[model samples]
Each structure stands twice: as structure tokens, then as C-alpha cells.
Target chain A: MGKQVPVAEGVFTWPSDEPRLIGSKCTDCGNVMFPTQSGCPKCSGQTTETVELGRTGTLWTWTVQGYPPKSPPYAGDASPKTFEPFGVGYVELPGEVKVETRLTVSDPEHIEIGMEMELTFVPLYTNDDGDEVVTFAFAPTAS
Target chain B: MTTDDVAIVGIGMHPFGRHEGVSGMDMGVSAVRTACADAGVEWSDIQFAFGGSAAAGNPDTMVSKLGLTGLQFINVVNGCATGGSALFSAYNSIKSGMFDLGIAIGFDKHERGAFRVNTRSSGLGDWYGESGMALTTQFFGMKINRYMHEYGISNDSLARVSEKAFRNGSKNENAWRRKPLSMDEVKESAMLSYPLTQYMFCSPGEGGVALILARADQAHKYTDTPVYLKSAVVRSRRFGSFEVMAPSVALEHNAGPTVDASAAAFEMAGIGPEDIDVAQLQDTESGAEIMHMAENGFCEHGEQEHMLAMGETEIGGRLPVNTDGGCLANGEPIGASGLRQVYENVLQLRGDAGERQVPNNPKTAYTHVYGAPGISGVTILAK
Candidate 1:
């Protein structure tokens, strides 16, 4: 088996069939934040608990990133001839938070606001060491 | 009632466009000199200076170029709101009776293309940079898309905004994109992000602007046409307001920064949106202008389509906006973008805006600039 690495550690649960994005829920204010938080941003509450986010969400808004963005931090393949456009949006997890995310679909016509989406892992790119780099994205929930 | 009254005695700016050989420092010097000349004051006569820039180096460098005057010089950086923030600082300095005459300058020379923001500097985690969602244009495209869907705005409204920008830009010699673009041309332009064409987005270009401000009582000594600064307010986003650079948003929806900034400005100026005769707004993209119109209380939600259709935002229209062309035509030089709005409004108030001047002798003008992560700065000026 090849070595698999997450795009960023601690963002989502790993090595599991049912991985969920990690978030923090303030015990004092009930405010939730994605990728967890050291303290509540709203009420400055220190008593917070890390919780797994919902696996499914509704697409709040989306757009097709037709052009290759500037690189440095952007590790995606950006060569115009080979570059593939992709979808980006904010997905509202019920009663939690609206998380900005990448979508599995690139075609704008295929996606609609309020559409049901399920979180899944996808390969962002591979590093020189032959580790498969994976990141999270949302796709149409299998009906 | 006029305790905090400040006045802009003079204003100057280098034309907005590509200046192949010119450095930002040289542009800054030129603008400062022009402003001093316009105010009929010598550089030595200036008491203090506050400068704003993102890409450019220390503004204290101006002291070496202008003259070695033992004056307090402060440099500030607040993303795209740098200019307005600098002006706010200057306004407060005079209002506090700390200094009578001070200058606020904004200058930058950015590499052509979409602005590359340093995620670390902007206080984002490494995960955000790795997600490939750090692009500003993508943020704009996403927010504007949702806004369009919720408000029933058509693609035509976006194109019309760009069309009007270029049309108004053609008359302003200082504008970068002076060639008028028809609605069809804007629609047919190459798509950058979904529903946003290349023409709809403003490029990051090079420019510099300077304003000489003084206490109202002393302003008449500098220039007879001193434009009174009624208010200069800057606000950051409240929780739940959507903005660029955030990885997530709160479930609650709070009024964004522009709303808060503009409202504070109107209250300070003791005027309403209807009282603004000519205006300049942040047009980083066509969609921003449409949304900002409603956000700043210039109109109500879903009224941009009808407002644009009726020519209410045109040069001679009832509420002439971006009269000297806006960021769409000026090409945003981040730090200088907000002050560029002030430069145009000053011209409009002084009846010096040549061909693009509004029909009626404009009295009050409003300017707003929004930056990353939901920061907005607003200023009101009166003749």
C-alpha cells in the first residue's frame, strides 16, 4: 500500500471510512467553528469541545473557478493546456456553520444552490516523495 | 456640532495605469508636490504626514525626497482600506487639535494580474492556503452569485455596471481603462469566474494619490475651495457577515462592514443617501458595485437592476456614481484605491471634473471602500 497524507492534518478525521470535518462547539455560547478553535470567537468562551461536523450539507452558493489561480500556495496543476477548472462554494451544514469548500463538479450547469452534497476525500496532487496528497471536497450525495 | 470638522485643502493623483519605468516612490513624490502646489503651501509648511501603502515601502521615505522636515510621519497598512484609514487618522489628528495641517498619501505599483495575498500575513492558517480557496476573485464570484440568486439580479445587470464604468472612464483622462465597453461586449468577454467576465473585474495597477487636510478654521488659508470632510469612518465585519478570505461563516447574518461604515458616516455628516449628489464606490468587480449600492443605503435590495436600467447611476443620472470612473476603470492599487475615490469626489465637489462632471453643481459626495475579510471605510465630503 502507498503512503497517504492529508492536505492538512487535524482538519478532518483520517484513516476511517466515515471521516468528518473537525469543528469546535463553544460550551458557553453554542457557537461552532470549522477546523476547531482554541476559544470561541463570539463570547471569548474558553470551554469548547471538538466535534465532528455533519457529513452532508446544502450548497449555499457556488461558482466555477474557470481560470488557474496564481501559484505558491496553490498546488493544483495550472498549465492552461492541462489545467482543469473546478467548482468552489460555501456549503451550509445544518445548524452548524457555512463552510467555504471545493466541489467535485467543475461544470456550473451541473450544480444548483440548495443541492444536497456529501463530503469525500480527493487527491489534490502528489508530492515528489510519492505520497498521495488528499483534500476534502463535496459531491452530489448518492440518492 | 462642528467640533470634529476637518477639510481637504488640496488633492492630487498620478494617472491610473501602467507606468513602465516609474517607481511608486517617484509617483508618490509627484502627487505630494502637486498637492502642495495646489494648496499653495510649501512642503516645509506641512506639520505632519500619514501615509498608507501595501506593496510600497516606508512612507517616511517621502521626508528624504520632499525635504528633511522634523515632522511626525506614520505609515499604515489595512489592506484595500489603507487609504481611507490613513485619511481617518489625519482627520482625527486635526479634529483632536494635535496638528492643523497634515497630508495623507497612498501609493502603490503592483504587478499586473490578480493580486496575490500573503495568507500568513492576513492571519489565515496553513490549511486555508492549502485548500486552494484563497483566491479573492473566487470569493467575490461566490458571494455575488448567491446575492444574484437571492435578489433575482440578471447577468445583464453585472454587464451594465461594467458598461457604465468604461463609459464614464472614457471621459476621465486619469482612468486606466478609458475605452467604453458596451453591454454586449462585456457579456461576450472571456469568462474568468462563472458569471464574471474579464471586463467585469478590475486589474491591480499602479498609482498614487495625496490629500492635504486641515482644521476647518485654518483650511481657508490653503485653498479657497477647501472641501470639508464631514466624516471618515472605518468598520470591520460583525459576526455572520460574509466576506473575502474567511474559510467559514456564522449561521447568523449581521449587517456587513459597509453598512455600518456608511451609516456612521451619514450620521456624522447629518445627511441621508438622498443628499449625496455625486459619489464614488468600490468597484473591484461589477458585482461589488451592484451590491455596494444597496449596502451603502443608496438604494434598497433588488433595486440595482431597476436603478441601472433607468440610468440612475450614470454621470448625469439622479445619483451619479463613479463620476470620474471607479476602481473598474482606475485599476485597484490596493492601498491607493480608497483615496482615489476621494480624489474624484474632491474634483466633483470643486466643479473641476471636466467632461465627466455631473449636471447639477454637486454639493455632497460619498465614498466607500471595502477590503478583505469584511473591512469597510466610508467618507463624506461637501463643497
Candidate 2:
């Protein structure tokens, strides 16, 4: 594998300046799925295409990570002192697509399903060579 | 509480195992063919079809695996509950009066290992671990430890459940794991999850199960005594575990999907615990079956061990559960398990379950099917 970059390439990106997540739309069922996929689960026939989603969405659910997850694919250390309580929640976009991602709020109690939120880029952590690794998260949008 | 009437006229299973030659479509064809033969109906006679599959290798390219040619319906891949999802879809289609007969088919030829939904397409959540955390065995392992901490249930009781299932499975030609296992042997088995021995966790297997749903009038043409679908209820997790209450049966506390779904099914079926003569509960882990019993109202909360010790759930007991040895003995076919449980329940109610058959010959039976990540589907069938 190539050296880890500031941002992982081939992770998917939108064409426009507006921050948005990527997904695949099923032409057969009109259903949309996030993180992009090759096929639809409902019709199992049609192939999927990389479609851009709205930058803003509603919070479908939220939870605070009580403990660090044990697997990789994440870039941070699990030191209790350094690792802050990270919150994860489901953000519902326009179609039926619901994306699960890290939340940008502090207190998890305030988060609830149907709460309006917007996508915001956040620095996940620093890499071995001191490159600032960044990722996308959702934050409550001011009404 | 009464819903639309539905009846199961035919049910068939291709014995579960690791077969190198047959693909998922081949398995589906075998199962569908058997079900048609058993129901004495022609394939063209069916009006609709619902396909359930999970790890379909080259799934996108293989649409005809389920024999869904001209039939119009849905295809669901809901992790472990795939079969239940298909059953629900088929039931709804038949209930709509659009078709006189509906076929629900599920097939999976997975190699022994973990299961994961590629989030890249569905983007619901981050991809779970491959061999470590994402595996259903490890997920149930975590739940098993928590259940032991809360319930103080004994290892012996769990072993007894496994032993009974293995003994029963030995007689089932269609079961994947058919070897007889003793309680001592179960207890001595290697540890896959703490407080749950290897025998306690369900082993992955390959299998296909097919069910034929028809109108009550048409059902008699296929089988003498039809297994009517009194209700098929699915409970979904509206939110994450953070919002869910601590493990308790209190309506306020989150009893998880199992309790909620079972309650809905019971209401729809217009039946209570007293009316149920048999149950085929998902015991992917020992705690699952025991906890589900209380949730499904088979017994009071935290009283499963006592009931088991009293032989209340045995073949001759008040509520004979898993008369066909549940996942504990049958081997977890992942996608095929939901319909497999229904097949067993119907067999018992029809008095066709040879050695493992309940003596009373049940009139009303329930199957509480659950998945690892938190999904429950309950189906109640009446003779």
C-alpha cells in the first residue's frame, strides 16, 4: 500500500464545491445507499452509480463511544487520556439514504433523530509523518 | 388484532452443509423444486416470488438464482433475518389478493467464516471487523457474557439445551450438524465465547429453504392440514443502543426487538403464551434462547433456567421449544434459519416431526427469529 496520505484517495468525492457524501441510486426501486455500492439490495438486478447526496441532513440517532473500538480502519490511538468521547450518529439525507458518521457535538444527550444537521470537515488525527488526517462529520445546523 | 389470513401449504429444505459444487442458485432450485413437489403444485402455478440471500457471490450478476423470472416482488438481504424478511414480503403480497400462491425462497452457500454488509453501497455504518468483531459468533459472545453477569444462568442448563438439540438433529436428515452431543461433551467443548462453549455458538452452514404460501382455500389442495400464518411481525431498531434502555422487560426499558416484535405478533395472532404449544426460538447463543423465552412470554423474566430445569420446554412439557434442536443443533445457515424454524414448527404441528415431535401435537406455534446486530422477526402459525 502507498504511504497513508492526508486524505485517502479513491475514498470518493463530490464534483461540486458543496460538501456531500457519495451513494448509489437504484434505478429499479429508486432507493439510495451511502458510501457507494455496486448493486441494490431491494431489486438485486440493476447496478448502482456514484451519486452525490445533500450536504445537510437530519440526525436519525446518536451515541457516545464508551470505549475505543478494537479494529483498524480508524487512525487514532486508544490512549484513554488522549482519546476524547467521540459521538456517532445516523444522518438522514433527502431520499431514504441514512449515513452513519461521527458527530461534531460535545454532549450526546442533545442529539435526537429528526434533528437538522450539516456536513463539516474535521481533522481526524495526525499521521506518522505529521500529516494532518481529516475526515467528514455532521454538526447541528443553526435554525 | 386479527390480520389477513395466510397459510403455508408447502415447506422444503436442502440439507445444510459445505458443498463445493452447488452455487446459491442451484441450492435455491433444489429447495424450490422440493417445496413444489411437497405441495403438489407446479412452478408456473405460483403467482409471486420473494428471494432472501446474504453473501451471494457475484450477487448482482446472478439475479435468476431465486427463479424470479416473471414473478414480481421484493428481494431482501437483511443479514441474519433475510429469510424472515422474505417471508414477510411474500405474506403481504398474498394478503393483497394479487396472487393465490406466493413462493418465499432463501439460499446461502457461505464458507465457514464471518458475515459483513458492504457499507460502501449501503453506507449505514462503518464496516465491522472481518474475523474478529463482525462475526456473529463474537457479537453473541459479548451478549452471552453480559447475560451471564445479569441472569446467573448455569452452564449445565445451556449444555442441556445443546445436548437435546444435537440428539434431535441426529435424527434430522436435513440438519447440518446431526451428530449426537452429550451435556458433558458440550460442557467440555472449546471456548468460542466466554461463558459460551463452541457447542453453544451456532456454526455457519450452507443451506436453502423454501416455503409456499397460498390462500386458505387453495392450501387444502396441497396439504391435508395446513399451517396457517396467523401473523408475521418484524421489529426494527429505530435508533442505536445509546437511546435504548438498560436490559429489562419493563415497557420503559428496551427489551430489544425480540420482545417488541413478539408482542406485536401475539396481538395480531390474538393468542397468548397459554395458547402456544410449541416454539422454535433463535438460540444463536444460549442466552438468546433463554432470554427470548421470557421476552416471548413463554415464562416470567429471569425464570428461564428454572423452567428449563423443570422440563417445561422439553418435548412433553408445557411449551415444547425447538423440538428440532434450534440453531444449537441444526447449524446456523444464516440466511436460511428463519424459514428453517418455520419448517420445524409446521412439522411439529402437522405431527410429522418423527422422534422430536411433541406429544400433544400443537395447534398454535411461534417462531422468534433474531439477528446479531439487533433485529427481530416473529411468526405465529396455527394448525
Candidate 3:
């Protein structure tokens, strides 16, 4: 295996057996935001702290991306010959926030609203540098 | 100042479709000329211009088509709310007595496929885009699925909305998709996203719309039946509202921009949703129309199913909506889409909508447009 690389830096921890999403928590309102924010969007309070979000969440809603999106940002292997649709949705991480995410399942029939899910890393694509580009997604938890 | 101080004296549009070999500027010129002719005013009479476009070039280019009169020509780009924002600007300018006659123009010619994502411009980091969550279609699908589950809205109801849109489009000569679709056909359309079929979504296309506005006192000088601008309000997202293109949402829910803008418009117009005779709400997708009906105070939550079942949203229904086929049939040309809503409302209010005209002469009309990451524009017009 060539080295592993995250699709983007600073969104989550990498190279760990168990990784969690990085976010910001408003010390005043206790509000949490993913991808981190400079300040609280709610109370507009400057006081905030970095925090790790919960790993488990429930499916708020979902859909199958039957069509491959336009390129540049979509660096996946989406050639018409090999393109396969996938499931995407919002996962409610309890009281933290509803994170928009790609689901592991591609079949809409297999997914249900309010289904339990857990955060996990998945290979988005390999870069020209021969490194595995990983991104975050939610998958059905065995529990 | 009161919104009624300004009035729409003229309205026109370049038919919504693929204008092969036609430049966006030419389409805009055509629309502007049509509006000026309809208003019985010469280009020299206009004092100010507000132009909006998305993929098309700067709106100031319109000065080349319509002679530059050394008047203010401001260009606007507010996602899908572009036209509505321009209209708002013109409304304020006229109401402030800064100009007696002003024009708002929206035109666009977009390349095919889903709207290209500009991660930087969208305020989304590279990770959000790389995760494949940036597509607007997925957002609509996900939001509608959650809405259906929470409100017990059925798939058939979703199909019914599309059916009505196409049926209404069939009578609109300017609409891109003019063929009526059966419910089964709509339901069986290719699945773009879960619970949302291909027919449920509106594709981006080429179009242009223009409106001529004047002080209410001077409107009769241009036209005998000027459509009064009762309200023109634009709103941004409030914290916690479910916004398409948002990377994440707050734990607590707040009213979306459509609700906020519509509420403000109703207050300004001095009319409730029930008081409006005809309406045009954003139908970026069929599900949006259903939810917007409730959001705009036209009906109660979970009341859309009953309304659809009773045929209350059809052309002859109690409150005919999207009488010009809406975005579903018009194909959303971003900048022009919002103003297209106003143009359709103006037609209905003037009793000039030929085949798709609402049965009773609609004196009051409501129009709304909602764009990504949370923004909404609403305008109420009266004859």
C-alpha cells in the first residue's frame, strides 16, 4: 500500500484506528458545528472550543445519487462505463448537528429513515501520487 | 415607504427553452424591447436598470443592446433569487423618489447538466465537495424524503404535483416542457434521487425576463392596467433552517427563508394567503412546491395531501398555482427564474394569460423564489 491521504485536511483526525469528526462547540449556547467555525452562528459569541463529534448517529433522510455529479470536486471514478450510484443523506448526530454525508448503501430499499449509523472512513479515490484518498461516510452499524 | 408606491407597468419573457445559436444578450434585448413596447415607453424614458444573470456575462452588457443613457445599471447575482433581488432594488429606488421609471432584467444561458459546484464560492471547503454531498439534486431528494416521512406525505402526492405542473405547462406556450404527463409516467420517471423522480426535478435552461416599473402615480402614463407591487421582500437564512447546499444544520430547527420572506410580504401587502386569488411559488422540484404551499401560509402542514387530492392546486382550483408551468415546465434559468414568477403573476393579474388564465379574474397574485444555502424572495402583485 502506498501511503493513505485524507480527501481534505482539518475536517477529521487521520491515521488513527478510531477517528472522530472535528468541530467547534459554542461555550455559551453549547451549539456544535462541523468543519469548525470561527464563532457561534447562534449566539454570535466569540467564546468557543474545539470538540470531537459523536461517532454514532441516526439517518435523518437519504437518497440514491443515481447520476454521477460534474467533475473537479467529484474526484471519484465516475466514468460512464464504471460509474455506480451511491446513497447520500443527512445523519442526525444526536444533539450535535445534522451532518450531510454519503451512505455506504446504494440501494434506497435497504435504507430507512431513523436507521442507526456510525461514522467511518472510505476510499474516495487514489490520487495521481498513488496515495489512497479517504473521505468520511456513515454506514449501518451492527448494533 | 409603502411597497404600493411602485408598480409593474410592463412584463415580458424570452420563451423558456434551448435558444440554439442565440446569445443571452440577444434574448435579454428581445425581452427588454417587448416590455418597453408593452409599457408604451421608449428606451429613453427609463432612468435606471437592475440586471441579473448567473452563468451569462455581466448584466451591464445590456447597456450595449439598449443604449447607455448614463443611467445607473447595477448587476446582481444572488443564486436563484437574482431576479427577485433586482426587482427589490428597483422597487426601493422608485419608492424613494430617486427615479420615476426603472427596469429589472434577468437573463441566462447555462451549459447542460447539474449546476457546476464552486467549492470556494459556495463557502464549502474541499472536504465537503470531495464527499459528494454538494449536488443540489441530492439536497432536494434528501430534504423531500425527510419531509415526506415526517408529514406522512405519499409518493402519489409527489407525482400529483408533477402531473399538475406538466398539465399547466401544456397550456403555456412559453413553457419549455409543454406536454402533460400522467401520474404513472411521472412516478415511473428515472430516479435522480431517492423518492424524487427525474420528472420531479427542473433542469437548468436558457431564458430571459424583464419588467418595467414606475411610481404608482406615473404607472397609468405607461399602461392603463399596471400591476401594483404590493410587496417585494428578500430574506436570508435564519440559523437552524434546513438549507440546501449547507454542509450541516443546527440541532434546533428554524423557519426557512421562504417562510420569513412570505410572512414579511403578507404583512406589507396587507393580505393573507387566503386573500390572494392566484399564486406562483418556487417549484424547483415538485416536492418544493408542496412544501412551499405550507411555508407561504397557503395551507397547513400535512394539508398538501388533501389539497392535491381535492384538485385545489389545479388551474381551475381554489388558488391556481404556477399557471405558467412554474420552474418544472419553464426549466429554471437561475437569474430569470424568479422574475419569470413575477412575469407570470403579472399576466394572471392583468387577465391576459390566454389559455392558462385562472378562471376568475385574479386581482391579487403572490410569487416567491428560493435559492441555495438559504435565500428567498417574494413579491405580491395586485391589479
Candidate 4:
């Protein structure tokens, strides 16, 4: 097993038992954004503050990525022989914003809209330095 | 109310498909020359021009081929609305009383396979594409999936849209995909994304289109049967609309840009949807056609399932849509797709469409095109 590392920095909290995704909130109009944008889209507010997003949300919409995406833009290191289809969806964190993320499910029979989902980290690929590069995802709540 | 004040005197197109040796600029020159011949005007006669393309070289650099008459040539690059923007510019120029005649030409040659977008150029972070969530087809799947869930639309209705596209394509000579397809074949095709089949999507290819615009008062001097441009409008997405390459969406819901563009076009033309005799909508995929049908106000949401089943959108039906095959059969030469719609509508209004002509003389035509980052353009024409 290689050492674990986040795919990118400033996306989520590190070294924490409760890893909440980081986002931004407009101090002017109270709009919420993921990945912490510079300005507020709703009110054009220049002043904003970073805030941790909710850990759980409900699935708003979803689809199966039935084929491997094209490379150059996609850095998953997926080849035709080893690639697996994945699920993509938007998870609404209630009253804040709906964040687009990779779902932990692929089969249409397994996923449903409005299902309870919780944010989790998963290995996206391995780097050349033998580090496991992980990204964010949402999975169906175990209940 | 400025209705029918601008007229399209001539239209021309280079066939849409894989042209092995043809460069995008060559096709553009070919289309412009053909339009000149159709309008009985020389290249030197065009006082100004507007043109664009996504992959092809700049349009303003074609002065060597078009003649050095010192004409004002502006280049437009509105992603997929390149042609519409060009037309919009030319129409406004004539209406502005600055120029009496002008031309709008668009052409593009895209490489094979899916388009590889540059994240930095699109103002997106590297993680977006790096995480495997940037595929265009995936967004379409999620959109139609949510639409189906909300409006009770069926997958069968989605397949029917493609089925109708190919059938209409078979009747047109210049369309790229001329072979008609059955609904079952569309359903059974390869599933690249959920709720969409390979046969249901339009492939990016090569082509060129040009339309000569003249003031209505002077149009009779060139062509007696002029197709008048009643209105043309372009709009961008509002907040809460689901657009391509978005990391998040507002919980608040709103209609897409197509709704606003369609409404403004109808209002500017001083007419309503009921007055349109035929329509040419952006059919990037089968599901897009269905969604646009309602977004453009041709029908109500959730009514598509019944409307598509009743065959009211067919060539011989109540509303003829994409009679010249649209983007599905024409292939999307990004810059040229919008003008292709206008070209087909002109053919229909002039009774020049050989096999795909709508019955009872379609006097008014509506055209709409939607593109990435959420932009839409709508145009209305009447004879």
C-alpha cells in the first residue's frame, strides 16, 4: 500500500475525523459556493469568507458515466482494459448549495434521486511517486 | 414594429460531413461564392461581413480570397452560437442604417473523437477535468434524467426524436447522416451515457454556411422572393440554470437561456409561437430536441411525451421540426450549425426543398441554437 494524499489542496480539511468539504459564503447576500470562488455570483459581493460544507446531503440528480472519459483533460490513468463505469451526481447540502461530485455507485439499479448521501474520500489514482491520490465523493447513507 | 424589415436575399452551404482534403476556410470561401452566385452579386458588392469558427483559422484573414475591396469584416466567436452572432451582427448593421447589404458566414473543421477542452481557458480549475467529470455527454444524460423524472418523460420519446431526425435527413441531399434509423435501433445503440444512445448524439464535423442580408426596401432589386428576417436575439444563462462545466448549482430553479431568447424573438417579430409554420432547433442530441421543444415555448413541459407520441412534430404533422435534419444529421460544424438552420428554413419557405418541403407553404420559420456555458440565440423569418 502506498501513502495516501489528497488529489488537490484547499478542497477539504485534512487530518480530521470529521472531514468536511470547504466552501465559501457571501457576507453580502448569503450565497454559498463550493471550492471557494473569489466573488459572489448572486450579489457580486467582493467580500466573502470560507466555510466548511455539510457532511451529508440528498442526491438531486445523477447519471452513469457508462464509458471511460477522454484523456488529456481526464487524468484518471484509466485504460480500456482496466476502466470501470462510475456514477456522477449533484448532492444538495440543504439551503446552501448543490455540489457536483462523483457518486460511490455506478449501477442504475442501486442509486436513486433524493437518497441520503454523505461525503467521503476515495482513491482516484496513484501518482508516479507511489502516493495514492484521493478525491471527494458522496455515498448512499448506510442507515 | 420593424417586422420583416431585414431580408435574406440568398443562402448557401458546403455539405456537412467528413471532407478529407477540404480546409475549413476553403469551404467558407465556397459557401460565400455560392451565395454571391445565388444572389447575382459580385464579391466586391458586399459592403461588410461577419464570420466565425471554433477550430478553423480566423475569418478576417480571408481577405485574399474574398477580394481586397476594403470591406469591414468582423469575426465572431460565441462558441456554438457563432453563426447566430454573425447573423445578429449583420442584421443589426442593415437595421442600423449604416450598410444596405452584408453577409454572415460560418465554417469549422473539428478533429475526430470527443473534444478535449482546456480547463484554464474555460475558467475552470484543474480538478474539474482531472477528476473525470468534464464529459459533455455526461451533463446531457443527467439533465434528461432529471427531466424524465420531473415531467414523466419516457426514454422511448427520446429515441423517437432521433428516429425522426434520420428520417428527415434521408429526404435531404446535403445532410451527413442520410440513412434513416428505427426507434428500436436508436434504443439498442451503444449507451455512452445513461438515457442517451450513440445514434442519438450529433458528431462534430466540417461544413460552411453563408446568408446574404439586405434591407427589405432594397431586397426586391436583388431577389423578388426574399425571405425576411423578422427578428433575431441572443441571450446568456441566468443563475440556477444547469449549464456545462459547473461545479455547483443554486438551489433556486430558473428556466434556461433558450426561454428568454425565444420569448424576445417572438416579441420583436410581433408574433407568437402559434404563428410559426416550421422550426429548426438545435438538436445536439435526441433529448435536446425534446427539451428545447418546451423551452422554446412550442409546447408545455411534460406534454412532450404525448406530443412526441402523437407525431405532431413530424414533417407532415401539425409542427414540422428540423425538416432538414438539424444538427443530428448535418453534423455540428460549431460555427456553421446556427446558419444551417436559417439555410434550411429559407429553402422551405421558397419551396426549394425537394423531398423534405413542408406542405401548405410554410410562410414563417423559427430557428434556435444553444451552446456551452449556457448561451442561446433565436431567429424568426417570414416570407
Q: What is the per-residue lDDT of model 3 for residues B1-383, given as tens digits with 9 covering 90 to 100? A: 24348899988789998989997777888899999999998888889999999888898887877887788999999998999999999999998888899899999998887888888898889777777878998888988898898897899998999999998999988899999999999989988888899999999999999999999987889888988998999999989999888878887989799999999999998989989999899998999999999999999888999999999988899989888889999898888999999999888888889998898788899999998868999999988
Query: Which of the numbered candidates is closest to the native, going by highest DockQ?
Result: 3
Tens digits of per-residue lDDT, candidate 2, B9-89, equal 998888877778887767777888889998998877778778787765432233354454566656778867889988998
- When sorted by DockQ, best at the front, the candidate numbers are 3, 4, 1, 2
Regions more than 4 Å wrong, model 2? A1-143, B1-4, B57-69, B116-132, B238-253
TM-score for chain A as predicted in candidate 2:
0.83
- Model 4 quality (TM-score): 0.98
Stretches of candidate 1 off by over 4 Å are B1-4
lDDT of 4 by residue, A15-123 (tens): 5787988899999999999888889888889988999999999999998887778787787866878889889999999989999999989999999989999999777
Reference-based TM-score, model 1: 0.98
Model 4 CA deviation exceeding 4 Å by range: B1-4
i-RMSD of model 2 (Å, 1 decimal): 10.6
Interface RMSD of 3: 1.0
In Å, residue B295's CA in model 3 sits off its true spot by 0.3
Model 2 chain A: ten consecutive residues of lowest lDDT: A1-10
Q: Which digits, one per residue and each the tens of the lDDT, describe model 1 over residues B214-252?
A: 888877898889899999999998888999998889988
Compute DockQ for each candidate against the true complex: 0.77, 0.04, 0.82, 0.81
Compute the DockQ of candidate 4. 0.81
- For all candidates in order, the CA lDDT equals 0.89, 0.70, 0.89, 0.90
Chain B TM-score of candidate 1 stands at: 0.98
